[model samples]
Target chain A: MALIRKKIVVKNKQGLHARPAALFVQVANKFDSRITVSNDKEEVNGKSIMGILMLGAEKGTLIVIEADGEDAHSAISELEKIISAEEEK
Target chain B: MIELKGIAAASGISIGPAYKIGKEELVIEREPIKEQDIPIQIQLFEESLIKTRREIIELQKRIGLEMGQEEAEIFDAHLLVLEDRMLIEEVISRLKKEKVNVAYIFSGVLKKYIDVFSKIEDEYLKERIADINDVGKRILRHLLGKEKKSLGDLKEKVIVVAHDLSPSDTAAMHKQLVSAFVTDIGGKTSHTAIMAKSLEIPAVVGVEEATVKIKPSDLLIVDGNKGIVIIDPDEKTLQIYGQEEERLKGIAQRFLSVKDAPAATIDGRTIDIYANIEFPDEVPSVKLHGAMGIGLYRTEFFYMNRKDLPLEEEHYQAYKYVAEEMKPYSVIIRTLDLGGDKFLSQFEIPSEMQPFLGWRAIRFCLARPDIFKLQLRAILRASVHGNLKLMYPMISGIEELEQANRILEEAKEELRNKGIPFNNDIPVGAMIEVPSAAMTADILAKQADFFSIGTNDLIQYSLAVDRVNEKVAYLYEPAHPAVLRLIKNIIDAAHNAHIKVGMCGEMAGEPSFALMLLGLGLDEFSMPPQVIPELKYIIRCVTFKQAQEIAHQALMLSTGREVEEFSHAKLNEVLK
Candidate 1:
């Protein structure tokens, strides 16, 4: 198994808040990859809406997304689309 | 002629037999049980849980179809908390270890959760504690084999007297069969008060000991406009009220005859009569009352009673639903006016000595642009569905108005970039409620497209009287000279700026204030839908000239008492 890692700045205005966090978890759960998102200090499961919200990733915050599985590449790219996309989902 | 004074929750007169609804006081007694019966007790708890789950699911579906899907999702969260493994495990462990009854053990565990959740700083988590308590109560009811009492199927039309009514109870009631409502608790803005106004029933709330004093089947007369309730009246009092009721019924009939007529004065002055609503479900009533449009569609209810903030899609759907329903007619949706007296469980609002004067309405929204922008974006998106306009509540100055407009522009830009459809030319307005806002109407009128006077807050703020406080409630005078001058100033300022002004507060619905407002140059009158017909009848009967003369005289009065007396006398004389 190969591990993929990506660091991205939260671009959406609301950060990883309610609606945005819900969308992030929905996209993260679509792939078979085991995904984890972390700010500098703590790591949380990317597929859990509650976990993602607890990360408190506001706009301009730096966070890292890591995935390990057969579909790690797709999961990372899709998750990044939601996080970096300027328009809210 | 015993008269009990309370808050005038809703307008109109209702005389009927009292129908007392006793509160459901479910007593849970702690009892020791045999250790060997632990398995049976656990089985009983499981069965009750399953039953409660089924009931919640049914309620969710019904509420979704009746209200909106967003509202229905609250039940989904309730279900999740109901099925929480930690809660269930704790209850079972306590039951087994303590060797107590399942009902007692379950309540103990539920209390612990509620206590801890209530202390949390997060408003959302604190709100979720209510869901847990609701679920716990349901399980206890089932465990005790008590049937839930509902007001859905009443056989007679009577005046309902109770301590207080929950939102769900009001929703489940057969509104048509209720002639009036008298409660032991609640103030002007309470759920019961709002519901009574929307349902078009006479109500007097905050009548302490109403449920206890009024026996079932006791003859009662409820004067909602005066906030008076008479129980078991004598012959003379009954005769007087009987004649009054008959006269009111005759007036209502005459009003209905001209329901579809345009609200134009005999002198050819036209006035737009609109309706104020809190729920999307009230749109039908707005139209039924022959309203020209919705002047104030409150958006606060969407933010209430839940753990999570409403998503943009939810706001869009609710706004779109109201706009689409009132096609060709304007729907002025106000932004979230939370905080102060109307606190959201989802936010941690520090307790204030005077909440009404604290951080509230537009102030709260401005502080949290992220939440405010989400709502603005939703309203803009729904603007394309119909004639949708948006307004900001509790805007006290030009700076707040400018800042709100700037954020609105940003929301519009966001939508434009995403290629989402919206009415770019939607009119923006500000509510002239605070005394400062009324005083600065000229400055605000320059930046805002329109103004709607919210007299409820205006009166309270000007008089420095809390409408909810019984001791000082009498000082919350709507006919005060200061309030009248402020209203006149706002209307004059808006007109001078070439913008239309309207009133959508309780003052707009008061019969005595109708002619005064019309004469004061109010372009529109938006009130509870039920009062539209009668107010329209008043408009049609009087000439604009007569109203202007009466208003002029009232403005010269020295005291609120004089103003009230003059208006009352003039109303009777002119209507006759």
Candidate 2:
């Protein structure tokens, strides 16, 4: 199993707010990897809505998204797109 | 016919088929399961999760069809919460070790998540706590086998029976579909009771086992005035209540007939008749009931029923709406009286032994000037909209009053520095709720622009009786000699200082108490909007001189019961 971690800056105006967090959880569930996201200080399960919401990442907040499994690379790339997007998809 | 005794929460009578709402099952009963039942408990947990997922998916589809896709998207988060492996695994693992019912185990796990999310200061995360709680409740409900019906989905008019209704639950009710309601718990001052009064519907509360005793389509007769509910009544009993209901309807019409007239005595003494509102939305009803203005606009609702602190703009808009609506008339806004029986998770107020006597009301505001001045600034900004007044609750002496004013001055200076225009001379009042405040009313009134007696707290403090405690509720009499003396002292002091004194308490809305209060020379009377018409009718029928005579006789009575009976007789005589 491959473990991958990437420190990505949240560029969305609202950061990883409700819509972004929900979208992230949906994408995270598709992978066999165990995903965790942290705002440097406090980390939460990237796949758990409650945990992802607990990070409360605002715009310009730096978060580290970690995925550990065979599909870890694809999970990080997919989530990175949503978090770095300027507007909510 | 089975008769259930309850507290008469609202007046009048109604007969209808009972429509019971399955209890949402927030409180779970922990049944210790045998070791052999572990597999069964595990199966129950899995089944409930599946049921909750199906329910959410079905609801989402329906909402998508009805309210559109955007609104339906909120449920996407709920579905993920149900699928959260960490949460589900924790519950299943805990159940096997603890060997308890799955419903109880699920509630404990749910509470843990809610508590964790609630502690975080982030606003976005705070709102998700509600979603977590909502999904958790649905799962718990299924585990306990409750197929609940939403209050909004009533097809026919029926008497609503429940364990209790929250403010939001009552808000969801359609007035026409809900002819009346009877709850298993809650007292006279509960929000359910208050909503029933405002809805102009009959209700009986505090009926033990009301939900269990009355079944759906059981044919219930709710006698709200007498605090009685007859389940499946006989022909003779039904006929009696049917006529009694009509007689009450006629009386209600008479009360409504006096709606437009000012509440003035026969001898030309006009008192300011006002309504006490909890929400800004109650403004239209205030006018419909012929209230001169809003006397007490309890601002705690801005804090309650929500996560995170309210922005200054939100407070300003609410105050501005009420101020403009009641333009040329006064709207007294009592600032955040947060922590007495109100669970304020936002403040994280340290749990106290005696919350009422402990750090509460003005004390909480004084300690947190950041929160206090935020509200004060909003009130000041809104004051320019129309006639608006602000009052400080639980001010015991001149020191607290002076301290509050000092903060008020800082708020004013901030506005001045920002060059924001507000009414510079907004009437600042003191609420005489504490015993010390009542005693020192003369001193406080010297600086206060007005005085509003909050008899609910005043009586509780003076008599040393917890109003919520049933055992001491008998001791919590408004007509108690000590309470009357304090009120008399307060009114006398306010008048002595040339400031108008009003009463915005349970005592203010009551007919006999209103009669006694008028004689006591109270300049204003404020109560719930629904009570305004009857009070106005009573005021118009009697001369001020006669009320003074009744008050004089009541003052002479030694016991509270005697004073109550004497004043009640005087009120009946005036109405006759």
Candidate 3:
């Protein structure tokens, strides 16, 4: 299992809502790995656009992205790019 | 002709066939499923989800092709909702546990999700509840094998009839194809009114059973000027309305000529003409109509059309934008006046026997200082942007006025501690809507810097008549002896107390009532921007002395009908 976990400060001004959240979910769905994202208290399936949005992570919010399975490394990197990019990827 | 009455929302007359919009409520009863049927139920849910997804994509593609991609992007949120793994899994899990029909379980789960989202304080997420509800309805319709009508993709112009038009429904409306709107439930300040005014279309709301009475394509006459909708009018009546519509167009052109003139009586008494705006989008139109200032900048929109309470910054930003836009002219904002006919589910405002007489306006604000002070603080912060003033609506007496001011002071103190600069001496006013407030105008005027008579509620409170009830609509007369007497006393009290009195109501905008109100020494008149030029024309045409004389004669007459007739006659005579 190529499990990967990394933390990143939300760089996009709109946090993970709108186009950014959609893009993150779309990328997460492409992975053959189980992906999850967590704020401080709760973790949710990274493949859910609603879950990402329901987190209500504003700009500068610290979130951890975790992926478990063979393509975990790639999924983590791709999802991380969405939240880290100042503009939509 | 069968006539039904409602509150006059946006004024004008339109003759068109009816297009009834039925209430979109799908009742679902839980039916037990056997253990063997669990897989079948799951399949049903999955198929409906797939169907809903395809329908949304088709709609998105069509809307993109027709209205451009920017407008079609609103459905992106809906698509996310349909594909939400968390939501779908929860429904399937609950369906197995509950052993209930898939449709019932699906709708129930959707309700829970909606509850969770609505409870979220984030404004962006709060806005998403509309999308969720929209998508939820689509999925349920598919599961139940039912189809419901939506206000979408209209082929021709028609008068829309509905039980109630929600914020989203109004937003989804084909503005060009809908000639007018008639709804079963809503007051003058409801969504229908706000949308109708912004759309510059005629609408009659609170016409009970309008959706029931008018069939699709029924020939109709919607006289928003009188708040009456006639279904299946005969030849003569239709001809009369057709001529009246033409005449009004001519009058509109005539009014445009004097739009830029100051509203002054021939005998030299000047009345400040202002616009009553619900939101900032109307500011440009307010200027076009030559309003000297914004007299009643209603802040209720913050609470309306959404689930969560707006953040203080939202209020501050909007108020600041309007205040900056109307720099020299004063903007009088009426604070959050919830309850009564316009109650929010978020507040859990109870159904009252007489909502208008129950907890509302300043009463509701006084009880909820946490909510009230947040708004007050925002208003205070935005006060520095221009000539901004604030007023409390439905203030019945001195106690409510003082309590409200005490909270305002607390807001000021909070701002002061933060070193936020605001207009320290911002003028504070109290809206005289209740009879008690009108009777004690002198006492209120002591603490109040000014008074804006909200004649809509004043006439309702004075006559003890429910404004929305068509059976008693005749009793809800603005020119009733009791109503006029209360108004006279209020104006007199404000003048005696050295505070100016203005009116922001339907009565203030009516051309027939303009002269009498001028005679009563109303210092200001605020209404929908479209009515400003017409009222200004009436004010400019008559001498204040002549108006006073008309007022004197009209007051001597006992009935509201007589007073109205006299005012109409005098208006025609002055124009001649």
- Residue A22, candidate 2: alpha-carbon lDDT: 80
Candidate 3, residue A22: the lDDT equals 73
Per-residue alpha-carbon lDDT of candidate 2 for residues B260-321, written as tens digits (9 for 90 to 100): 89889999999999999977767887887799999999988787533368999999999999
**By DockQ thresholds, what CAPRI class is model 1?**
incorrect
For all predictions in the order shown, the interface RMSD in Å is: 10.9, 12.8, 13.5
lDDT string for model 1 (B1-576, tens) is 567889999988999998887886789999999999999999999999999999888877876665545456666656655665557877899898999999998888778766754564543443345456667778999988898888886888989898886555666777678999999977776657766876667899999998878889999999998999998899998888889888887877898987789999999999999999988977876888899999999888877544478899999999999999999999899898886556464565654666688888999999999999999999999998999999999998999999999999999999999999888899999999999999999999999999999999999999989777679987988999999999999999999999999999999999888888899999999998778998999999899999999889889998988988888888788767
| B513 Cα displacement, candidate 1 (Å) | 1.3
Comparing 1 with 3 on DockQ, the higher-scoring candidate is 3
Indicate which candidate wins on DockQ. Answer: 3
Q: Judge candidate 1 at residue B551 and give its lDDT.
A: 89
Question: Residue by residue across B328-350, what tens digits does model 3's lDDT show?
Answer: 99999999987776635346554
Winner on lDDT between 1 and 2 is 2
Candidate 2 TM-score, C-alpha based = 0.62
